[model samples]
Target: MSTQYTYTAFLYWLLLAGLIVFFLFLSWDLQLFQTIFVQDITRISSLIFILFIAVSVHCGYRSWFVASQSLMLLKIKKLSLDDLKLLSDDAFESRSVIKDFLSKVLNSHSEPDKTLATEVLAESLRGAHQVGWFMAGVVIKLGLLGTVVGFVLMLSSISAFEQLDISDIKELMQQMTLGMGVAMNTTMVGLIASMTLGIQLLLVDRCADRLLLETIDFSLSTVDLVVDNRGEGGAPLSAQK
Candidate 1:
């Protein structure tokens, strides 16, 4: 399939992914959702948007990062000039190289920057949020299109009879129904996905915050170990939990 078709297919798949995630949340426990509904609707919407951002970003980075780990992608932040040259060269041998390079670039951790956790979270989220933005725009345009078509149906119902025919009224109602369905489907799905995603994102964001805290602790106490090439001496991976 063409790249465009493939991407479009992924968007559809993302919706399915969102549905699955929702069901999984319910299976795990649905009480969390109840608390959210009690809050303001506007707040709820914002939360949903953020969820879309988080899920998309987390998922996008997870796919690539997990794959790179199998190749023993240690010291991603330490790639040298030679590695850069290898990456930039026309002679690069593998499709995986670009992905590796990206993994390294995104994984960078330098001095005086924000905590590694924050940077990592921000960098990883770009692609997913991009997808979310595109989907949101599509929803808006589709909504508008539905609005226009609804109007057309209303106008079409007013024939030269100058009096409303029962048949015309029935036909107009059907046309309006179809038009409204086409118009609102995207927006409704977008909003719902956005809301569900928002809730998921809050859980993730809080988790990330906690992880960042642990990472900071690791950085402070293990600065010597990390800088001395004793990365394994840092805190246990599960410390964040």
Candidate 2:
């Protein structure tokens, strides 16, 4: 991939930007983090959010770069039917390029190229794009925890032996507000992250599928030509596989 728009480079910048945003929010909302417990939870949520975004970008980049290369290969006016098969083989299994990591376990079999390609595509789709599904579960658990803690503190504050006073009421209000804030913040953050990641992943998956289908269609046409007994006597891709 080109350095100017490489996914890895984008991830480096994105993570830096995310950290800056997280810190800026923390700095501005310093009151929220004044409680040690709030600070700890926020930090952990921020870490998970960053990981999802990084993975999403990587998946998108891989899909685009491979599709772009495949299109270029298809453009050769003199490309023989066998050439199409070679292109598919080279695109999925060539090991010299670091991008070949997509084929970490290439094997020979029926439609092996498409199988390996789909596996890589599926892995990225699940790991990077489905982050929202996982986070939704996490956020619900955390939100429930926050709510329980908040109510417990509410009961404790009221039960203090000292007769309830204005100061006491004010403290209770603050505890309730903090609890609501924690619950709402985590839930909102999880939803927002999941929505964005899901969209990115969906787009990447579609593009990859489109690329593979085009390649397969082209290769099948080539195979038919080779199999045509009355046509030009050309060798089938089977000879090389």
Candidate 3:
């Protein structure tokens, strides 16, 4: 009956849903994928783009998992300082950033400890966002690379048209049309892939932001509870300074 177990199950279902959608698309028209890949001016780049998308999806899944875990922790109502301490210990043992952060704050009675914990938390947040953004940029750049390759193919056919006789005009036009098709097809595929992947990355970012805010709230609450507990024992928090 743990929320973490339920959340994990939900993520598994989401992954299943994605797989079903992919299979459905494949069944509807298998040739669409073939056309996109087979006819691409730079098939290698197209393959690389697909690889990047897979990587992005994986990164997004990881971000979602962390966000869900944090949200579950935050939903605990009427949590006491002891409960917070227990959660921190559990988190540290489980290798969770939020739990680790709480553990740090609980152990940190001095300014230096607090500063170090803050730095560690910031680094964790930065790393989560950095991979998503970096992959998004790489996907977009691959699309642009495909666009350039397409244009080059189209332009290269232009010289053949000039050397052809009048009777060969039809053949010349056909060649040029083929080149243009290659150019357009690759460009279209690249752009669409880039846009879709970028949107997914954006979603991951939004989830990360939510996770971060929740952690900040928890951290502040933990600090206040620790200070209050110390005060009740006739020791002011300032004494640590």
Candidate 4:
């Protein structure tokens, strides 16, 4: 098997790091952190910011996990039944995703079920990123919520006006400015957070998909069940290949 797929996680993290660096530079250049966190009275931007970080971290962990499983799959792809049995005896190696899967195949007395394994792999590999995707959407909604709150704040200032006077005009403008800032800042933060986290989770999802597909192929072509063909109604190992 080509080892090219094993680099997926490394490349993903490298690209992610580059993006983070660029974004940090941009934030520092524009003083964005202070503007969004310090200037906003509603603090929605802060919440969104924190959630984005959390979601991103989770995404990174998932990516690494899927990648590790892929590596393990590659390692044992050509192992025979006896070889797999020897590996499974090691406590640490047996804990790996591919090892656990092969253990199931090795122990089954019935026909090897590739379809069931595919479903199991899909759930194990691809399902991990769903939470991050959801949270990314929440970040965007939070930003919009900030926008609505800011607009309300702006409108409330206007409502307080008994009459248009120069002194009151200055105060009203300040209040309106504050409200607008809240709306714009929150909206901006939410959008940035959502987009960044969405991109990361999307990459994780793709990596997971690739891992699952490759595992399916490997299982179909390589892994063989250790069962008696005539007695147990199981196909011969050669038939599986």
- Give TM per candidate: 0.40, 0.54, 0.73, 0.85
Residue-level lDDT tens digits of model 4 in 37-139 = 8879998988997898788778778877877787777667545444555555766454676666655655554554645655676787767677888888889
Backbone clash pairs for candidate 2 read: none
Worst 10 residues of 1 by lDDT: 68-77
lDDT of 4 at 182: 96
Scanning candidate 3 in windows of ten residues, the lowest lDDT window is: 232-241
Candidate 3: where is the Cα deviation over 4 Å? 1-30, 71-79, 83-93, 230-241
Number of backbone collisions per candidate: 3, 0, 0, 0
Greater-TM-score candidate between 2 and 3: 3
Which pairs clash inside model 4? none
Best by TM-score: 4
lDDT-best of 1 and 3: 3
Please name the candidate that would achieve the greatest lDDT relative to the true structure: 4
lDDT of 2 by residue, 20-78 (tens): 46864885598643453353344444554566556555654655564444434234213
Count of backbone collisions in candidate 3: 0
lDDT of each: 0.43, 0.47, 0.60, 0.74
Best of the two (2, 4) by TM-score:
4
